[model samples]
Target: MANIKLALVDDHNLFRRGIASILGQVADFELVLEASNGQEFIEKIPRKMPDVVLLDLQMPVLDGTATADYLREHYPLIKIIVLTMHDEDRMVLHLLEKGVSGYLLKDSDPDEVEKAVRKVMDEGVYLNEFVSRAMLRKMTNKTTVVKQSTLYNSKILLSEREKEVLKLICEGLSTAEISDRIFLSPRTVEGHRLRILEKTGTKNTAGMVAYAFKNDLV
Candidate 1:
């Protein structure tokens, strides 16, 4: 495949710069554009399209939710991956219901962030471990308004490669270990980790294990 063009849409310049710098070292991806808010992201994208977008949930003019709605309405072909700090189950489900392809926490390490990018491009859903649990609980109760199958949809969305990542994560493998075992670069494993977190709604590996035990994924 050709190089993936990614756009960063977040209000924090420093965070955006940090992520860009990390992707730069990978030497195969490009941070094609950076925008402070959703409006700016829209304006920038009209001139060129990115394969994927790393969006922030909180922003001044256009938050990730509104931005996602607009993107889904207008540019259905473009994929969005939410990179945010919000761990609230409601907020996470809102983004997913908006059709975001991936979700990652802001506190996620840089390596996991990259894995998010790859998983979204290759698979379709990227969930953090903690986020997955919250989302699943809310989903099971049906109080969050996410349909019954939405959580199951997460499993269906992952590729075989991502499933491999999830199984290892549930088994307590660290990112570096997963990298070595999977023959993926560390950065790539990090990306997959982020993706797993988003898809399963689990935050850490331990949480993922609990989720597996609870759901019998193991």
Candidate 2:
């Protein structure tokens, strides 16, 4: 298979170069483009489109959030991974709502960077430690609120097997991994995923997971 093309958008030249050097050593990754800010990225992306982008939240001309919005509107196929120091829950959730493929801190290990890249390429989502912790805290609070008002066994009826599949999906298991764990064929697992999406009225896995969380189904 071809190397996954990657772009880096940040105002820090030294950091960008450091990440570029690291990705250079990885056989499966290619550093295709580098930009100083979101504006430059927006201008350059049309000419040198990449498969994935490692973006910083804060930049000079344009910020990551604005750039992410632009990408989601115009270049939705290019997967984005936010790599920044900001770990605030509000910012994390905002990016998640905007459909980022992954989140990582600037202090992440090189191996973790590689793993995040592979995970997003293979599974379409990767949440780092800080983001995961924040999300878990939010989920817990939401679950507490939901338990009091909403009945767990309500109108939304799903089979026990489908519920198990949805739980694994919320836990970030890929279709093939869920199949392996449940001793089912990948096709069957995919069918279950489709059914789950239909039952939840979600268009994608991320939406399905969000629905599950909102309803305290996980």
Candidate 3:
């Protein structure tokens, strides 16, 4: 199998070089490119797109938050792992909101770094140990800000009637069955389903089901 393509983006020259050198020892990873800062990363990314990006938060031009936002819009295919010294919850939460795959501290060992890169590439998410523990606490307490908000927006983005129709669709109801359940015509149920897809960014029945699964909307 080919190695996973990776990009290292940071403001500090020495730090970038050091990480590149360390990753060189990992045969399963290929250092496809490097960027000095977030702005440089955005400009160079399209030409040398990597499967996973190691992004530093504090950069001269375009910080990690901005970089992540742009990536979410333009390069949604790319997975971002935040590599930063700042462990502040505010910054971490902001990047999470912007759709980062991993949150790793600068002090992480090379082994941990390699693990994070590989895990996110495979699993779509890789949180550092500390970040994972914090996330666990927040989740247990029902204080995970984004999860709730995404669900809430998904709710308002689809009306109450739409949600009723969505739940039935997610339960594997056909348009005809949904029509019988909701007293609407089959064509009307389909229209509601289409609007639900538009509201929730789902492309098909499977995607709609997945959205429902992830947000507990079912």
Model 3's TM-score against the true structure: 0.66
Cα miss at 135, model 2 (Å)? 1.6
Report clash pairs, candidate 2. Answer: none
Candidate 3's error at 32, in angstroms?
A: 1.3
Once superposed on the true structure, which residue ranges of model 2 sit more than 4 Å away at CA?
Answer: 142-161, 194-211
Per-residue lDDT of 62-119 in model 2, one digit per residue for the tens?
9999999899889988889999999786677667757788888899999999998898
lDDT tens string, model 3, 155-218? 6566788989988865545677789988999888889888877776653443454445444454
lDDT of model 2 at position 194? 88
Per-residue CA lDDT of model 1 for 11-114, tens digit only, reads: 99998988888888876798888999999999999887988899998999988899988998889767788888887766665566566876788888888878
Q: Backbone clashes per model, in order?
A: 24, 0, 0
What's the CA RMSD for each of the models? 8.8, 3.0, 9.0
- Candidate 1 TM-score, true structure as reference: 0.65
The Cα RMSD in angstroms, rounded to one decimal, for candidate 2 relative to the true structure is: 3.0
Which candidate leads the pack in TM-score? 2
Worst window of 10 by summed lDDT in candidate 1: 209-218
